[model samples]
Target: MELHDRRQAPWHDDSFEGEMVAVMTVGVPGGEVLLETSRLLLRPWRVDEAVVQRELWTERDPRVPPHRRIDEDGHPTVAELEDSIRTHKVWSTGLLAVERKASRDVIGYCGLVDSGRGATGEPELAFELLRRVWRQGYATEASLAVVGWARSSGYERLWATVWDWNTASRRVLAKVGFIETDRKEVDAVHGTTLFTTRPL
Candidate 1:
């Protein structure tokens, strides 16, 4: 998938214009920073983990819409994963791998992204864990950290989108203080998408 260009300012609602200007002045973080939670460590993508990241793309849950899964051809090639890592490296505050503190295993990725789906161009929180790790509260835990990081980074607000069928994700957003917004969109594969947001 094509990544959002981090060089551009995130979109925001009209009421947030002043806050958005303030965020732009502060700018993005300059380097990777480790975020620690009770049971996980969130850190930058590593080149050696390309294969692990590719498995994540290809092994999504069956409930996920086709368009959100890996391409029909198969798992992303190693080269593709490397390219993705390179793109992620460009954004100082982009996605990071979630490592379980107990096993030291990388289970998934969670972080912020600039999204146009809301037409607000603001940063959107995103996360996906391996199917094996579902229902373990990892998503909510990692998300809380990301939200806290955004607030401390000078963002005025953050946004997110969830497929209507993704009740689990919706709950996770709620746990992290995101409220459903009036904005919605329909996609050919993912069906109806609900937008949500929270102030930083």
Candidate 2:
């Protein structure tokens, strides 16, 4: 499992969604990469999953990166999350509800954001999982699939911005193959931090 140099990474001609992705077991080759890993399924987001959507607001203290959390109110309303989903419909993003199949729970979301492309213009990757699901590899798994989608879907890179102090999100971004692509100080409506990314 030695990592390949990004400089020499092979560029596949196949466009995402045009062909069936190859999903393979670790150490196996030539399988379509749908990225349906154990305990998680990477898919699209829906507005109906709002209660879980409120995880964006509810799980903030001590965990959520500054950029990910909502306002000073410290509580994200399901109405706000639902409005977010409805707004995204006007422009498509890979925003998906991360549901735990065993419990049929809509725990939270992970996906691409149309804006915040960083200096490199890589579509930014974003996620806000319920506090209950932290440390379970769900964020990493979902982010991996998102990175895969970005690669296969004609995108040369992906980005994620985080408060440098948010160690958990920093860990998730690192686990998903995004490197520190860029940084800049912006007036923090809330907290002052920025972490951007490019292709791995």
The TM-scores, one per candidate, come to 0.77, 0.67
Candidate 2 structure quality by residue, lDDT tens digits, 1-200 = 00111112323322223342322222223211224444555444566777666655655775445555676774467777678766654112356566666776767777666564454445678887887778987787767656665565556766688876777888988776657644655544445466667664
Q: In TM-score terms, which candidate is top?
A: 1
Measured with C-alpha atoms, the lDDT of residue 67 in candidate 1 is 62
| C-alpha positional error of residue 111 in candidate 1 after TM-score superposition, expressed in Å | 0.6
Q: What is the Cα-based lDDT of residue 138 in candidate 2?
A: 77
